[model samples]
Target: MRTAYRVETVRAAEAALMARLPDGALMQRAAAGLAGACATILGRVYGARVVVLAGSGDNGGDALYAGARLARRGAGVSAVLLGARAHEGGLAALTRAGGRVADDPFAVLARADLVLDGITGIGGRGGLRPDAVPVVRAARGSDAVVVAVDLPSGVAADTGAVDGEAVRADATVTFGAYKPGLLVDPAREYAGAVRLVDIGLGPHLPSVPELEALQHADVARLLPVPRVESDKYRRGVVGVVAGSARYPGAAVLAVAGALRGGAGAVRYVGPAGQAVLARYPETLVHAGPPGRAGRVQAWAIGPGLGDTPGVDEVLESDVPVLVDADGLRLLDPAAVRARTAPTLLTPHAGEAAALLGVARDDVEARRLDAVRELAARYGATVLLKGSTTLVADPRGDLPVRVNPTGTGWLATAGSGDVLSGLAGSLLAAGLAARDAASAAAYLHGLAARRAARGAPVAAHDVADALPGAWRDVIG
Candidate 1:
């Protein structure tokens, strides 16, 4: 699983490593990796023009040391000093390697094949300093590939908040552990692709990780595996309270998703029986409220529920509830609060806004915060669906699950119903809210990726791909 930690956790990890080693050991390790990556990007070290945008802290020190390595290998290196005095040791190292400091601020950009943004790291707050902004802008305008030393300047390390201006990087080589900002949004938008440099801080980390992403393997392990003694009842029955005559396709999609969702049976409860029977004849369809639908191990609700009154019955059920689509729109937070069983809320940015009583743009801007806030407010586990799907639970530790497996094709219509069915089935089969949501997202994304395969795919095709995607994890 790909993981991320807060800035404070990073500093603590760095401190522990620094105490055990000789001075500057960690920074040297970081510089070596940074230099190697730069050499690869530039094709050759010799005669390559490299510009380092130097700042006040150790981040600049890392870039300077990397520049020194390149210069010693015959590259023409230049350090454009953004601070009055750069890291003393790093500046001296660069000069000793035959690197020159740019006498003119604008000259470095024109000749550079690559630019290193050492303007800020996790320690930095607010936006880029006025002096550094123009240089950052120039780097963006350049044809050269811009590589951020630790993180993109002006991006928040902890919250993924790009409150002010920031540098958009082609790549970021981060030291020790990943900052939470890289895994979340806004700041994530600036950071292109990320690579972690292991600086031996693994030993000093906490028992519960700060953030985590489920891979195919991890999701496979978390999924409920049927035993030799398992029966249909033991495997669990998923109750789907979805769709109306107005939008019968939702019920069909939900049942299609549940059939291959490892559930022994799918019990459909809604006004879309004809549609459900038409698409999936095996689904046991019932017409009326969720309470009247007989027994169920878990419940999936809200997709195509419309502005109807029956949804409240499903929301109030004792079974684990997976709320999505129209269910998200029609939810009564008070009823959700009074529910006895665990609830998982899956909402895209728009639905999330409605739940939080905020603007959709506001939810998207601070997705991490919005998800966490919703989980707390409703006392439920929230899966805020987006590029980086974030799962958080109220009354639990602060560890948030961020799904790394995502595709643009997931934006297609009726996609969420399939996800809800998958998650709800898992919950019925007995998994924690966090686990169910995370696993569902992982598999859902894998299915979408397989179905799309670089081309457009219909929602039904995505549902059809679930069995093969699940095999990727278990097999």
Candidate 2:
């Protein structure tokens, strides 16, 4: 799992390290990595023009020392101080290395090829102060490639919350571990592309990372596969309780995802019963309710059972139940707790807000917190869907799994239905609730990327491409 840490904790750790080392060793190390990234962007270290937006804290010290390195290489490096008093040691290092200091920020900024935004780091409290606002705004409006030190200034480091204005960088080069804001949204959108630089602070970090993201290899290892002797039932069976005469397409899309999923058989129960057969003839459709849907390994409820009633019976099924979309609207917290089988709740921002009784913005701003809160409250694996889809199970000590293979194209309607079906199928296949959800989200996102191909696609296109995605992962 890839992680990001908070700035205050990082500062405290740096102080501890400094106590054991030479006076300026840690800052020099941070400066070395920062300079290397600058060199990479500049291509030719000696002739490139670099502008450093220096602030009052150690963040400025990092940029200043890096500027000194570039100046020695013959690059015309200039420093613009946003604060009244810049780091004294860093300022001297820049002067000694022949770097120029510009009193007029506008004149230097207009000609730069690259901008290093060190105006604020983890320690920065508010948005760019009134005076520094134009400096950052001008750079963002310009064409220069911006590289932020540690984290983009003005963005909260702990919660990924940006209450005020923040810098939007072309790339963010962070030291030690990553900060949660870089991985979560709102702030995540500002961080165009993220790169982590190790400053040897990995040993002292906590076992339960505040946030975690899965890479391709990690997903490849966790994905389940079939053995030669495995039978159809041995693989898994997912029972689907969805659809009403009012919305038959929901059942079709849900079955589309489940049938193609690794599940051995898909049993459907609901009002739009026959419509599920018309679209997915393979589905074992039944009249009445999900209680009479016979035997199955897992159950996925609430894709489109709106106001038709009798959904309570389906929700009580003691199997690996996945509650989603329409089901989320009428769900009772007490009924959810009565199930003995592992349960997974897949909610987008609005649904999560309804489940937790908070505003949508609250769920979006603190997504990591919202997801954990839902897991503890519902006592089920909660999969919060958005830019970084998170899967957390309440029964285990597992950290939430953030899906890294997602694109904005996934915002299409009915995409959530496909996800619930796929994940529910995996649950019946005997994987842990977290594993089922993380695996399904990865494949669903990958399928969306492949199906869209830079264009818009319908929900069925996503399900149609699942086999290709599964093959790409397993083969």
Candidate 3:
């Protein structure tokens, strides 16, 4: 798992580690790692034109010191100080190593092979300073590969919010630990590729992280595997209430996802029973209300359930439930809060915006906050689906899980319906709500990537690719 800490916690950890080490030792270690990364990016450092954008902060110092190291390695390094004053010690070292302060920042930036952005640290809130905007823009317009120091300037480290002008890096070299901003969206979009530099701050940091992204091994551990003695019922039965007279395809797609989600048997109830049976004869079909559906370990409601009246019945069940699509529109916060069993709500940006009574743009801008708020309000685990799927628990104590695997090709009709069924199946298998949501998202995104492979893919293609993704994880 890739874990991220808040800025305050990271700052406290850094301070504790710095106290134990000798003066300037920590900064030097950071500079060494930064320089090594820069050198690696610029394969042949000899005569390479490197430009450093330094601000009046420790981030600037790290960049300046790194510039000195590159200068010693035969790279022609120049510094453009953007702040009122730069790090005095770092500036001196750069000059000693044959690096010069650039007289024309724009002229140097235009010709540079690589640009190091240290214009603002993680603490920077609103955006870049007025004076630094043009210089940052010039660096961006250049053909140079821009690398941000610690974090891209102008993004909130805690919330991943970008209020104004921000640096868009080709890659970011963050030290010690990953910031929440580096993992969450809006800010995550600004940070291209991220490389973590270890400065030995691990021992000093807290055990619990603010955010986490599951890797293949982590998902493998969470996935439910069948035993020799296990029967269909023992494996887990997922009850799916989806589809309608107008849109029967949603039921077929949702049931497809459920079947691939490791469930033993799927009992689908709705008007689209004939369509579902045509696609998947294995499914146990029912005509009316989901309450009459035999026994199920979990219930997956919503999808193409236009004006369907099963949300209340499913919510009343003791088993875990997953609500999505049209069901989210008919959700009652009071009913969700009243449930004893766990409930997972899956909502896209537009759906989420409607639930919270805010603009879709607002939810897109502050995904982390929106998910957390919705989870708290409904007293249920909420999965906000998008380019980066986020799962937030209602208690707000556990770290929000971020799905790292995905492609833009996932933005298609009925894709979310598939996710709803997959997550619902995981819930039926007895995984905790948070684990179920996160694991489903991980698999969903991986399957989409496998199915698309740089081409367009339909929702069923993603569902079809689930087994391959499952094998890849547990293999």
Candidate 4:
């Protein structure tokens, strides 16, 4: 699992570690790591021109000290100070090592081979300052490979929201642990690639993190493997209510996902029963309403269920229910909150925006905030699907699960339906709402990546690849 801490947590940990170490020891350690990373990026550092965007505080100090190391190694390093006062000690060290502060920031930036963005640290908020805007633009516009100090400037360290102009780095060298911003999107999109440098602050940090991404081993632990005594009934039956006459493929796709989601049997109830049976004859099909769909451990409702009456019946069931696609549209907040059973709502940006009564752009820009708000408003576990899928629980105590596995190929239609069915089946297999949602997303994204393999993949391919994805994780 890849865990990330909030800025406050990181600062507190840093302060505790710094108290035990000698004066300037921690900064030097950070600088050494930063310089090593810079050198690795610039293979031939002997005559490499490096520009450091130095700002106020420790971030600037790290950059300046790193520039000093580069200067000593025979690289021509220039510091473009963006604040009123640079790190005095660091500036002096850089000067002594033969690195000079450049008066013409743009001229040097335009000709630089690499740019170090220390313009803001994790604590800095609200984007780049006015004076630093042109320099950041020049660095980006140039051929320089930009690298951020901790995180890209102007991004919300905790929430991963970018409100204004921000530095877009080719790579980011983060210290100690990963910040929440570096894992989630908007800010993640700005940070091209990330490398972590250990500064020995692990012991000072807390056991629980602010956010977590489950890897293969973590998912393997969470996945339910059938026991010797397990039967079809004991393993769990997933009820899928999906597709209309207008779009029967949604039902087939959802069933495909549910079949491979570790559920023993899939009982599909909708208008598209004939279509589903055609593809999967083993599916127990019912042409009647979802109320008469018989026994099921959990119910997956709403992929292509266009204005259907079955949604209300499924929501009223005592079993766990997953709401997605058209079901998201017909959701009554009061009804959803009134339910005694667990409810999971999976919505893409547009669906999420409609649920919150906000613009789609607003939802995309602040995904963390949006997912949490949706979970609270709906009084259920909410899965906000996007480039970075997030699962947030209504209780708000647990850290939001950030899904790290995914490719652009997952944007295909019906991909979300597949996800909904898979997660619902997990719920049937007795995984908690948060665990089910997060695990399903991890597999779904991995399956998509495997199926696509640098080409476009249809939604069916992703669903078919789920079994392989599960095997890979467990093995």
Candidate 5:
């Protein structure tokens, strides 16, 4: 798992590390890494025009020190100081290495090959400060390849919220570990590409992280593979309650995903049985209420079930349940809170906004807060789907899972239905609610990227690619 820590935690860790190290040792280590990254980006540092945007804080010091290193290697470096006071030691070092403070910030920025953004650090609360706004704008507008020092100037490091205008960097060279903002959006969008440079933060940090992303090894461990003695009855069965007369395609897509989600059997109950059977003839179809849909290890409710007639019945069952789409609309919070088994709720921004009685824009803006709030309120594992898919648990002991694999092309209809079925199947296969949700999201996004392949893809294409995605991960 790739983990991220909160600002306070990071600060404490840095302080602890600094206490053990020699005077100015940590900064030099950071500067060396930053300079190396800049040199790599510039290809040949010799005579390369490098511009550093320096502010008042340690971020500016880092940039200046890095600039000094680059200057010594024959790069023509200039510092466009935005703060009232500069790092005196860093300034002297840069001067000694043949770099100068820029007489014209804009002029130097306009023709620079690379621009290092040291305008703000993790401690910064809001957008760019007023004095540094013009300098940031000039750097952004320039042809220079912009690289943020730790994070983009205007993004919240812990919340991933952008209050106002922020620096949009081509790449971000982060120190130590990943921040929540770098993994989520709208801050994630600002940080184009992220590279982590370890500065020995691991020993100083705690075990529990604020956020985490599951990689292939993690997902593979969570997935259930068939055993020699395993049979259909032992492998687990997933019951899907979805679709209506008005939208039969939802059932088909849901069943399609469930079929490949490591579940040995899929029992579908809804008005769209004919549609489901037409697509997946192997599916066990039932045209009655979900109560009589035979025994199932887990249940996935509401994709296209317009009125959600049997939602209560499924929610009352002892088995784990996944609620999504129209089912989320008819849900009773009290009933969800009363459930004994695990419940996972999947909601897009609009649905989540409605549940929290807030604007969709608000939910979209603060996805981490929204997901946590919903998970607490509903007493269930909440998966907020968007550009960055987040899975939050109410217990709050585990770090919120951020899905790393996905493409913009996944913004298509019926994708959520596929995800619901897949996650529900994983739940039936005996993974914990958080693990099921995270693993399902990982595979779903990977499948979407595989199916799309830089082209427009339908929802069924993503469902069909699940096996390939699973194979890729396990391989």
Candidate 6:
């Protein structure tokens, strides 16, 4: 699994490491790594034009030192000091290595091959200072590949919030460990690609991370595999209560995803039974509420369920339940909190906004906070669906799972319904709520990528591609 630490945790680790190391050894190690990354991006450093945007902290020192290294290698390096006071030692070193402070920052930025953004460090918040905005903008407009130091300046390292003007880098070279901002959006959107430079902070860091993203191997380990003695009942049945007369396709798509989600059988209860049977004849169909249906290990309700009456029935069941789409609307926090069984709620930004009584933009901007609050309020696991899907547990203590495998193409209609069914199937297969949600998201995204392959894909296309995605994970 890939992990990220909060800024405070990272700072503690850095301080611990610095105390044990020589006076300037830690900074030197960071500068060396930064220079190496810049050189690789430039390909041949000899004739490259490098511009270093230096601010008033250790962040500026790292950039200045890196500029010095590039200058010594025959590159023309210029430093644009944005703060009142730059790192004194780093400035002296750069000057000694044939690097000069720029007379006009814009003049050099226009001809730069690469711009090293060291304006604000991870600790700096509320975006860029007023004085540095235009210079940063000029660097961005230039042909140079903007590589942010540690983080893209202005974004909150812990929350992933880009409140104001922030550096939009072509790539970000982060030090020590991954910050939550680098992995989550809208800050993630600003950080195009991320490269981590190890400064040996791992030994000093805590065991549990602030955030975690599952990899292919991790997903493979969590996926359900039937044993030789396993039967349809033993593998587990997933009850799906979805689709109304207006949206029968939601039922079909949900069932499609459930069947491919390693579930033994799918018992569907809704008005769309005929439509579901037309597409998937093997599904055991029922005409009434989910409680009246035969035994199921888990229940998934609310996809395209316009005016559906079974939400309360599903919640009252002893088995685990997943609430999504229309089911999320008019949801009672008291009922969810009262449930003895595990409850998973899947909501997009808009749905999540409604649940929290906030603007959709707020939910999208501060996704991590929104997901956590929703999870805590409902006392259930929440899988906030978006470009970066986040799975937060009810207690709010465990690390939120950030799904890394997804394309923009996965935003099509009914895609979320497919995801809800897949996650519910995993829940029925005996996985914990957090594990089920994370694993399902990983597979769902991988399937979408496989189906789309750069073309437009329907919700059913993603469902059809699940088997291939599963094979790819296990293989």
Query: CA lDDT of each candidate?
Result: 0.87, 0.84, 0.94, 0.93, 0.92, 0.94
107-214, model 3: which lDDT tens digit per residue?
A: 999999999998887978789999999999999999999999999999889889899999999999999999989998999999999999999999999898999999
Q: Write the per-residue lDDT of candidate 4 for residues 1-475, one digit (tens) a residue.
A: 8889999999999999999999999999999999999999999899999999999789999999999999999999999999889999899999999999999999999899999999887988898899999999999999999999989888888989998899999999999999989999989999889999999889999998888989999999999999999998898999999999998999999999999888889999989999999999999999868778789999999999997768888889999999999999979999999999999999999999999999999999889999999999989999999998999999977888999999999999999989988998998888888999999999999999999999999999999999999999999
Q: What TM-scores do the predictions have?
A: 0.96, 0.95, 0.99, 0.98, 0.99, 0.99
RMSD of 3: 0.8
Candidate 5 or 2, higher lDDT = 5
Off by over 4 Å in 6: none
Tens-digit per-residue lDDT, 1-475, candidate 1: 7788888887888898899999998899999999988888888889888999989899999999999999999999999999778998999999999998999757778768889999877888888888888888888898878999889989988888887789899999888778888988888878888988787888888767778877878887788889999998899999998888798888888888887777788999988999899878888998867787778988988888887556677776778888888888767788888888999999999999999999998898788889889999999999999977999988658689888876888888888888888898888888888999999888889899999999988888888999888988888
Clashing pairs in 2: 4-178, 5-178
Mark the 10 consecutive residues where model 5 has the least summed lDDT: 119-128
lDDT score, residue 56, model 4?
78
For model 6, give the 10-residue run with minimal summed lDDT: 286-295
Residue 161 in candidate 3 has what lDDT?
88
Task: Count clashes in each candidate, considering only residues at least 3 apart in sequence or on different chains.
Answer: 1, 2, 0, 1, 0, 0
Off by over 4 Å in 4: none
| Model 1 alpha-carbon drift over 4 Å, by segment | none
Those runs of model 3 whose alpha carbons end farther than 4 Å from true positions after fitting are none
Model 2, 162-266: lDDT tens digits are 878889989888888888888888788888788787776776566667667876676677666778998878888898877778788888888888987788888
- Residue 252 C-alpha lDDT in model 5: 93
Candidate 6 clash pair list: none
lDDT of predicted model 6: 0.94
